[model samples]
Each structure stands twice: as C-alpha cells, then as structure tokens.
Target: MKFWQRLFTAFLQRFHLMRFFGRNRSFKELHQSSYAQEISKNLSKRLLNASRTQTNDLLKQFDTHLTGLTEEQAHTQQMTVGLNEVTHEKPLTWWQHLWYCYRNPFNILLSLLALIAFFTDDLTGSTIISVMVILSTLLRYWQEAKSNQAADALKAMVSNTATVLRHQVSAEDLELMHERYGIDTKNQTTHQFEIPIQYLVPGDVILLSAGDMIPADCRILSAKDLFVSQAAMTGESMPVEKFPLQKNLEETSALELDNIVFMGTNIVSGSAQAVVLSTGIQTYFGALAHQCYGY
Candidate 1:
C-alpha cells in the first residue's frame, strides 16, 4: 500500500497532478531558509537623534554637498526620495521560469499533440491526454489570474501615498527640551516640517488609527483601545490587542512582540501611532513573502 501511495504521488507530480486535483493538492511552501530569515530579522534600525548642533551640521552638509540650497528658507523645503523603490518588483528568475516550464511544459506539449492527434484520426492514447491538456491550460490560466489579483492587492497596501514627517527633531536634544523643543536652528524659528510620504524609513514614528494601513513596521508606542490584525505576517485568525511597546517588552513570559504589531499590520478596532521600525521588503510580511515565494 505504501509503495502504491508513493507511485501514485510520483504519477500526480509527473502529470502536473495538482492541476488535475483542482484545489485539493495545492503546492504549499513548508519553510524558509536562514538567508531569508536574516532579511526579516534586521528589518529596521532607528537613527539616533542628532542634537540641535548635529542637525545644524547635517543640514549644512546636506545643503553644501547633496542639494545646493544656501538659504535657511530653502532648508524648510521638503526633502523626499524614493528609498523603498528597490523592493517594488520581484522579477522571476530564469531558474524559476525553468522549473515552472518543466512542471507545466506538458500542457503546452499536450495542446499541440491534441491538435495533431485530432487531425490524424489517432485516438489510441490521444483522447484522454488531449482532454487533460485542455483542462490543464484552463487551470493554469486561472491560477495565473488569481496570483495576479493577490499581487495587486499586496501592491496596493504600500504603494498608496500617506503624509509622513521626514526630518523630525533628532532625539539627542535633551537640554533644548527645557526651553523650546520645536525650534529649528537653521530657520531660526519653529514650524512643523512635514515631508512627502516617500522619505519615510524604518523607526520614524507616525500617528495612526481606525481604517489605516500601517505605513511601516512599528512597535506600539501607545494605544487608545487599539486592536490590530497581523494576518499578513502571522496568519492569525483574529485581531490582537495593541499594547504599548514597553508593556509588551516587559512581559517576558509571553511573546512581547505578540501584542505589539509590526508595520503593515492593519488596525482593526482603535487608534494609535507607532514608531515606524521597518519598511519596504524589510517588513515582516515582506520578508516572509519573499521567503515563501522563493520556495
């Protein structure tokens, strides 16, 4: 019986068995490798706040070296760049195509054979094979369409634009906090310096609430009746409580990060903003998706 089971399994794989079984025997990825694990693990790193002096120094460097903006007024202008564009497309490799071609090559070949056999009036083995070939073509096309739809949905999550603060006060300004926390040294004044959505990297904090897709991976800084669904990364069935990152970390017995959702997790119930810890393919879902697709 075991030998027959093995033989049947081989037969199904050889003839693109999953296609024949319809949805019964779908190809599922079981695991991911360490290389992919590393991509997900070191997803985000926070940049240390530059002191007012450091911000001034960095601003001067930016003006003199990168962009030639001499006026202090020019510094107030938004600085936005497409940092996450590199992870936009995952072009299929030649080997991936080769493997797919090998798996489904029979469909194309069968299509041709069916036409030939039909014309030649050769029904010996052609009848069943020809029907199988046509069915396989329909199945493959359907799968491709479904995959494209899922890809489009995933792209929609990150591609849509959102307002983000680009150059926030660097965390190093402790003394300045005693006086005026909002003063811009170069501007010689204080003003909200919100930049475009593109410049947002990991560790930048953003405010979020009901009906907002997370801009990046963030540990919950605070939550007001917060609830988040992490199905995109963890495949959890329901939304979990969103807790302050500090509280989540202190509970050593439980998964600290369990209640603390990452970037791309949807806020299901309440409202909160977290420090964006990861972005682009560095996101938990992004990294996991990368691994799953590679397999």
Candidate 2:
C-alpha cells in the first residue's frame, strides 16, 4: 500500500497533475510561506512576459475569457489574492514628525549652538536659539502634516473607479440558465459596470479609453490603435502605441512589451480590452510602491 501511494504521488508529479488531484498549494499557504516574495516576483515576471504567449493560453492560466469574470469568481479571487490596492506607509505621528523636523542639519546646528550658549552663561542667546528651534520645528511639522493630508485626498479622488465587464446572473434565473446552457450561469452574459478600483481583482476584463487610468497590470486581449502614456513608470514623455500579441516577441525588458499595460499608466488615445494579470502588491506599480516605502 505504501509503495502504491508513493508510485501514485510520483506519477502525479511527473504528469503535473497534482492540481487536479487537489494536492496544489492554496493561495493562503503560498502567501504565508517564506518564499512568498520570491514567488510573487516570479509571477509578476511571468505575467510581464505574457506578450510572448498566446491569448488563449493566457486566458486559460487566469481562468477567464474576453467576456470577463463572473461576480462570484471575482469575489473569490479578491478574497484569495487580496484587494487591488497598494499598501501605503503608516503616517508619521505628531511626535515623530516633530523629531524629523528637528533632526535636520540646520536644526541640529541651532540646538548645539543653544546648548553652548547656556554653558557659556549667555542666557539671552540661548533663550533666543531655543525659541527659534521650537518655532521652526512646529511650523515645519504643521506644513508637512497638512501637505500629507491634501496628497491623500487627491490620491483618493484619482483612483476611485474602473470600468470592467462583469457577468452577473439573477438568482431566479440561475437554475434555468444553468440547465439551458449547461454552463456556469455567470458566463452566459457580461455587462459593463463602473466599480471601485479597490474592489478589482485578477482575471477581470477591463475596458480602456482615453483619459482612463489602467486599474491593474493586464495583458492586452484586443486593441485598436491603443496609445498609453508610460510617464508614470518609464518617465517617457511620448505616448507609446500598444496592441494585441499576434506573434511571440522577445524583449529584454518588460516595459518594452507592447502587449502588456501596467497600472498607474493612463490611456492617451484609442481604446483596448485587456484581462487583469496582477493586482495590489503583486503589480509592477505596487512593487515600485513597495520599494519606495522601504518594505
């Protein structure tokens, strides 16, 4: 019995059929592993090179179609992979902000001078320097806190919503649609809806038009003269044209792949339909954000 079990496991591994046998690691398990970061980076790289893959193959990997993902599937994916939002650094507390303000070279020099003045019995000079340091630190802290609040508000307004094709079925028609089509009722029809970008997940099919920000890293399914401004990522002033992958193309950098669009970029002209490849901290933009936050 032991020998047979070992043989069966070996056969499944050799055939890459462990997933079918329910032996594959769950998202939660992988996420909690020590190699999570390495796995995430590899997944991002794979999606970035998706331009070299066929559209059907890419769709199969994501378990989605051009018609988009069903509401239930999207919800499940969200729960598994987490939200399509970047993690931000914790805001500095008042004391921390004050410390930062006082830690500047100018403030340090002033503090040292004030201390020296006190030791030299120069009461008036020390008092003036101490007042100057306090006033400067308080003023700087207030200005920085206000600026941070304004920046947060602007960011909230900017990333509000995204247009995606979601398949939703009424509860009453669920059985009828399932019986008639002999398919998951959610796949029967797709409807365009503007949903909050934070609710977005991998496998979503999104529509892009001029002025709309790309919600997540996605592979282009079909495009029509699609032009995108990659200034946010590449600092390129000129908008680059993008299109569907008609053939396998080798590229040195993921940015050079015209078939994949990244989050944080916006459409400059024309339109496109793309399936989400990565989201949240797993996306290109999110990775950059993670680095910037020193995570």
Candidate 3:
C-alpha cells in the first residue's frame, strides 16, 4: 500500500509540473529564427516591427516565457496580446458594412416589380410600389448606419493590454518595477515572505479590462486610491472606493472588505494590480470570449 501511494503521489506531481511551469517545455517549438524572419510574413509586419528591436526583443522574451505555459495558459496569452489593433476594412464613402443589409433585397424585389408593371403598362401601381420600395430602402440604410455607429462606440472603449509587473516577487522589487519598469503594482501582498501576487496560479491571472468587462472575481492587492463601481455585480448606484487588501475576517462581507475587489467592477480611479481569484463565466462580467483568435 505504501509503495502504491508513493508512486501515485509522484505521478500526480509530474502532471502538475507539466500543467503549470511546463518545466519540460520544448523551446524548440516556441522560438522563431528571429524577428526579421517573422517580419516578412505580411502586412502587420510594419505595425509589428514599428517598435525598436529592443521592444521586439522584449515581446520575444514574453513569447519564449509563454512557452512555459500549459495549453490553457498559451491560449489566454494569445488572446490578450495586441488586442487593440484594428484590422477591419473601411467601407466606401457613402456605403457601410451594414448598408447592404438594408439596400440589396428591397431594391432587387422592387426593381423586378417595377419591370413587370412596365411590361403590363400599369403605371400607377408600379409607381406606388416603387415609392414604397424607396422608402423602405432608405429606412434600412439609416438603421444600419445607426447600428454601426453604436458598435464603433463600444469598440472604442475596449482595452487591448494591461500594464502589469510580469515579475514581482517581493515588495521591494514590486516598488522598483513600478518606479523603473513602468509596471503598475497597486495591488500586492507578501505570501510566505515573498510577494504573493508573483505566485499567481498558472492560467488564472487574466481578467478582461479596457472596453471588455472584467473577467472574474478579484481583490485589490495593490490599490492606489482606486475606486470601482460594481453596480453590475452588486447593484450599487455609485462607484465604491477601493480599499487596501486585507485578510478576510468573519465580520467582513465581500463588499465591505476594503482590501478586496470583485471582478467586473470598472477601474474608476488611480491604478491597481488585482489578484484574480475566479474568472470566465464565474465572474461578474458573466461572459467570456468563447472562440480564440490568433495571428
């Protein structure tokens, strides 16, 4: 029994290692020859390479490190990177993408009726149908135009990337990374004497921000007077003042706890690094991107 238990434990440990750190990851599959080689791939090459070689190197390092991710981690990384770059094509001066939705069918049907009336010499009925078709066509055009505008507004609010300290192991380095590396460190803690946020469980730190709704439930680990209105999640009317992270006490509810912040709450003020606890449909946003897109 003891031998079986030991062997089972070892097997579980090996799977855990591969599932998280991916210590056995084969870098050979992750590394590309060089950025220059990748640049020749196509159009985004310009936007991709517009940054300095040093910037490209940083991105390269990120990708290489991403190689240590489990299958799920790799998918999330691909989703968040450069999400703001717009690639949709613009329509002609007067026509929009949705314009065809309104114009095509009505015009075609009315044109056929008009042609049939012309052959039969029934000018009055043909004229009335023609007018009706024109009115409907115009209405459809206007409807599509308004829909496009609203969608654009929503897209404008979306955030593509969050600036966070990718490596923060101690409060000392946490402070330094913010000061020097341009990394934000508003929410943080020391766990087992090292910064706890750095030890975030694999495949769980990401939460949607920017225009996207928050992706999960979380607490503020580093709050610099940050405020969040969790009305969507909690039905509060005004934005709540975010407090410093604190240990949970029996008397403290999730909302009253100053140190903790829930997912789906907007970042109302200042800046922060939230410690994500739950995500996806489990979060207040209640929705997550179901499909993955990568370039």
Candidate 4:
C-alpha cells in the first residue's frame, strides 16, 4: 500500500481514540462501556444470583429451543459478548513508548539544562546529561517493550485451555471432544473438536469429566458424583461435590451454590453437563484475578 493511504487507514481506525485536550483513550474502553450497558438491566443481575433451574429458564426465555443455542445463535452471542479473555491493557506502539520516556519530568528538565549549557559553550554538564537522557530513553523503551512482549508471550502460551460442546449432530458427537482430530468411522462422519475455552459462548453445553478444567462460569445441568477441586481458586484444598439444584435457590449467592462451577476450578471426579453463563473477564474468577492484580 502507498504510505499516505496506509496512514489514512490507520488514522481512521484509531479515530475513536481521539479525545479533548490532546488525550487518547484505548478503543477497548469503548467496547467495555458497551458491555457495561449490556449488563445494566435486571437480566444480568438475576443470572449471577439465580439458581440452576432459574438460570435454565432464563436461557429458554431467550430462545424456544431446549437443545441449546443453534449455530446462528452461538455466532450472534459470540459477536455480542466477545472472546473469553481477561481484559489486557492495550499495547503502545514503539514510538509512543519512547515518547512516554522522553516526556519524563526529570529527563525533560535535564534536557533543557543540557541545551542551556550547550549554548553557553560549557561542554561538561550538558554533554553528560544529554548523553544520559538519550541513552536512558532508548534503554527505557527497550526494557519496557521487552518486558511487555515477554509477559504477553508467556501469558498466551500458558493460559488455561478448555473443551466445550457446541451445537452438534448427536449425543455421540458431543461425547467425542476431538471430533476432527479423531479417526473417522464407517458411518462416513466427519469430525471436529470442542472449541478452545476462549471460544465458548453463553448457552453452549459443556461436557465435564474428571481431570477436565471448567472453561467458563457455568451452572450444572446434570451431574454424576461431580466432585471438583476448587482449591486453586476457592483455596479449599478438599474437593467439593457439585450437583443440580432441585429447587431454585436465590438468597445465598451463585458462588455458594452447589450447582455452579467456575473457571479456574477443576473437576476431581465424576462428570457433568453444564451451560456457560459467563466467560472471559466477565467471569467471577477473572474478576478476582483483576482485583488481585490491583486493577
């Protein structure tokens, strides 16, 4: 692409960040604000506190089907809700990071002093300060960018992975998590895999088994001796047995409910079927991480 055209395209894409007083805010802030508006109503408030039956009813209320959301519905929700990821600070370009270092208060003062000394024909103070500021600016950018890149790479490499059930052909298909990766049968059936945890959306049925990680905050639909080790998140070393709530329990709280499993918790024994209610930073565990990190 031509330089000017590419520049114009970049400018327009970043136009939403334009603000008064020469300030800039990330485009992520706009998305977050939009998401906040989505959860302001009673619907979201009830989901966090409602019991299993009530939560299922809410899902049915949104759609007529009992087989979970159709592919179209899942896609729509994916676009509406976005990826299941913790919110990250938007990365700054190299120039922005360098400019940030250059604008440091002490460095700015030293730079001005250096300029004054230079014009006065005294080489010692100005020469030393100027060299220091330039080298420091370069070093600061290098350190900051390198650290940011390494953190991001490590985070991406090690983030928890999950398996989820999307709208599928049959019960048998749902049982085979790695549908595509597995060998084909004489039935001539093509296969696929349960999507990554990050791809999970509301209303998807998650098949849980022993040693499987709970991808998103979910409500138990049916369980068979489902004992989960929530120690990593809940700090309770003992495994907690989770089951479906017979009656709609409300006053206690979702976290206290035996029917709900959350992200970052693992299933220690038995298996269950669940529906994802929240994912990404909207999850309870994600919020806990954000708070622990002093967000």
Say which candidate scores most in TM-score.
2
TM-scores of the models, in the order given: 0.45, 0.69, 0.38, 0.62
Candidate 4: stretches off by over 4 Å: 1-45, 48-59, 62-68, 100-116, 153-160, 168-192, 229-238, 246-251, 285-295
Q: What TM-score should be assigned to candidate 2?
A: 0.69
lDDT of each: 0.49, 0.77, 0.44, 0.66
The superposed Cα distance between candidate 2 and the true structure at residue 269, in angstroms, equals 1.6
lDDT of 2 by residue, 128-155 (tens): 9999999999999889988999998998
User: Is 1 or 3 the stronger prediction by TM-score?
Assistant: 1
Scanning candidate 3 in windows of ten residues, the lowest lDDT window is: 286-295
lDDT for model 4? 0.66
Better of 2 and 4 by lDDT: 2
Native-referenced Cα lDDT, model 2: 0.77
lDDT of 4 by residue, 57-118 (tens): 75685452335555556667778999887776566777776787687688999999999999
Point out the higher-scoring one by TM-score: 2 or 3.
Answer: 2
Best by lDDT: 2
Give candidates' CA RMSD values in order. Answer: 11.7, 15.6, 20.4, 10.0
Clashes of 1: 4
